[model samples]
Target: MSLRRGAAHGAAWNFATAVGERSIGFAVLAILVRHITLADVGLIAIASALSEIGRMITTGGSGEQVVASPGDRTVEAGAFWAQFILAAAIAGLLFVAAPVLARAYGAPALSWVTRVLSVNIILGTFLVVPSARLVQNFGFRALSLMSLGSTILGGTVALALVFSGRGLDALIAQRIVGITFYAAAASITARWYPPAFPSLAAIGRALRFNIPMMGAAFVDYVAATGYVVLIGIRMPVAAVGEFRIAQRLAEVLRELTVFPASKVFLPVFVAVRDDPDRRFAVARSLVDVLAIGSLAAAAVAGAVAKPVVVLMFGVRWASSAPVFAALSLIVPAAAVYAFVNPMLTALRRPVLVSVFAAINAASTALAAWFAAPEGLLILAWTLAARGLLTAILLLPALSIGIGRPAWPLLRLFTAPFIALIAARVAAAALVPVLVQQSGLGIVAMFSQLAVGGIIAASVFLGTLALLAPRRIGTLLGQLTSAFRRVPVVAEPVG
Candidate 1:
């Protein structure tokens, strides 16, 4: 019952924020596309991406430490302050050095972008403890409201800026404003405050756990962002923008798909962490759910790749179509990781997981660097490889105490993949027939795509239900319940 309540609220908040932000974000992108060059947008992407790397490196494993150590308020506050100070210090130093870092990357325009994004670290610092407390208390509903209020504030400001000709400055300002609001809102919602001084002992313990987790987060960011950096340098901003759109669209689909399952599963993991039998049972159920959810999402993403891209971003972004299709494959792999990786953290093997993340990041970055074309295809291949590597590494670690996951569990993914392939083929076939000509008006193109995608999604969903009723049934039940009270949305993965 606690799980249901928490999840219900979390999903509601996630959904509202996701829908509002994404809709307004796409609008922001559309506005920017009309006003700025692709290169400018790409530079913004680079700055944001690099800041995430820095943030992860600075904060380290504090979050996982908090997660692992239950009900330790003093320790939690200590962890928050330590991470906050470190993140703020880094942000300050980085602000001064942003110009040099941009020069090092051969994109001097990124200096301002970097400086602007640095403030996010400070904003994030203030909110970390509060946000953590909310999640800790399972007050997802309140969390959702806080997040939406911030998002609406930010999105509204962004829209205004775009219309006022702020260009990419709108992007930077929107983030700062949004984070400020979010932090303030979450702080109010959680109602937990720290004293003037942080506990040294608590900081020490948090660092012990968080450093490795931070390392892992750093690697994850690097891996995901490496391609964007490479493209920014080797290709034009337009190309980078196209690629970013693909990545973003893919992630949106991923988040929407997994929100329901994760909410249902997080408390389950926390509860069964100490019970091997129950842990394994929960793990199996989660895997089944993830497989079904992921594949189903992938299918729809694949089917609508062309139409969705054109529908949302306008005709200029048609290049993103294939990239979206390529990225669609990584959704299932990410879903798998979401379940396995968290389980590892809960098992107190965060270091091992961090190591895995580092290896994955290194290999992915290397692959991106080596794959010179910088096309979505290469990016897709790199992500798929990373996903495969993560799964392989996790199986052995998870199997250690639980033996092996049931073999038949693998079969659950078969139907969804098949549906995805079929949808792609159908979309590919329909694109030419419906579109017939290139460079038509954006509306006409998107209309054709919408028609094609709806038809394809219907086929995909219907086929999955017919072939895998159990999975379909589980998904429908969650969706039904999720909408009944509040929308429970997932975090975007791909």
Candidate 2:
């Protein structure tokens, strides 16, 4: 079949895989929270963030290079060797930083936790090329199955560890297991393996393309999770845990709604890169769907953020609700990256993307530095507002990539913005009618969340349908056809 058909199939499988795996992942979090203390959560959050920064830096450009080159054995070997080398360097850095982190947080456990995770990152290096190869060939079906298996197996191991009174290990072990499964499974599925030796010249070529992406990815991750690091430093331990939960929930909504399309955007963009008119047209369509879907998801999540947080993580995490809402408000704005970055990469504009991410990262870090000491809610809103600012700042780059003025892109979010506001307003308006007390029972909170999410979403769709029927119709059309079954990747580009 055609690349268009393959992309739709990839989107379908990716969406399904995201839903299934994240559903289990969510359950794992909900379970872990009950048994795990806030202090332990804070410790792990800091460690995870640090190690993950390394992963983001090393893998960002290398994998994209693999996908861009397609079936180039030399490039694949170079990417793997490059990622592995970076992982090693980062692991060494983590080892050195471990003590500093422990002292900074007054959590001695972090030193060992950070050390263990350093090793995990090293093991994780093996997966990058295989994973990217799957994407190169549009083999998302195999990747999807591997993802589900990874999540399930990892979650199982985690729960067992937790029940056995090892909550910290549970959390870390889950990631390790998941990575191991996916790395091995993807390699098998793609029938690709690393060569016996490295290619210095190919590595140089890959680095030229990937170095800017490394900075972009690193800064972009810092923009999102930098608050946790700031909180761990400036605020109380419990606040770190609360913010982590809030971030996790916001991420869940993002993974479900925006990322499915994002997973396929690179390949799609690459396929159409040579045709400006088709490229811009495709970019426009995806951006609209991304904006609207992201807005709707964020609206509903924001509307029910309170009850959902309470019910899911227990009343202890109720404080995270406001934080989630603050973060949720920026979903449409932040979702811009999911589309824009991939588009920029396909357009050979990684440096521009780096600038975009750097500005956001700097602004967010500045905002957090001031806001963290004030309070969690203050920090959250500060970061949230910065997310919108990032979107505003990114429009010029987006316009340049598509060879259009910024107004057309700016106008795309108008209806979705309206719908998002309407949904939140409608949900808030129903609270007094539905909730009588803060100390309500579990069933009551469940009812509130269910009713609130449903009505909020309904309002969003109704507003969109009323305001822009044709646009809404097109978005719906994509969703409906996005599920037609087909082979994940029939052939490779090379």
What overall lDDT goes with each candidate model?
0.68, 0.83
**lDDT, model 1:** 0.68
Model 2 error, position 129 (Å): 0.8
Off by over 4 Å in 1: 259-266, 372-376, 381-390, 397-403, 406-409, 434-439, 474-494
Cα-lDDT of candidate 2 = 0.83
Model 2 lDDT at residue 133: 86
Residue-level lDDT of model 2, residues 172-231, one tens digit each, is: 998889888888888888786777667588778777888899999888888877457766
- How does model 1 score by TM-score? 0.88
Q: What stretches of model 2 exceed 4 Å from their correct place?
A: 435-438, 481-494
Best model per lDDT: 2
What's the CA RMSD for each of the models?
A: 4.3, 3.9
TM-score, candidate number 2: 0.95
lDDT of 1 at 41: 72
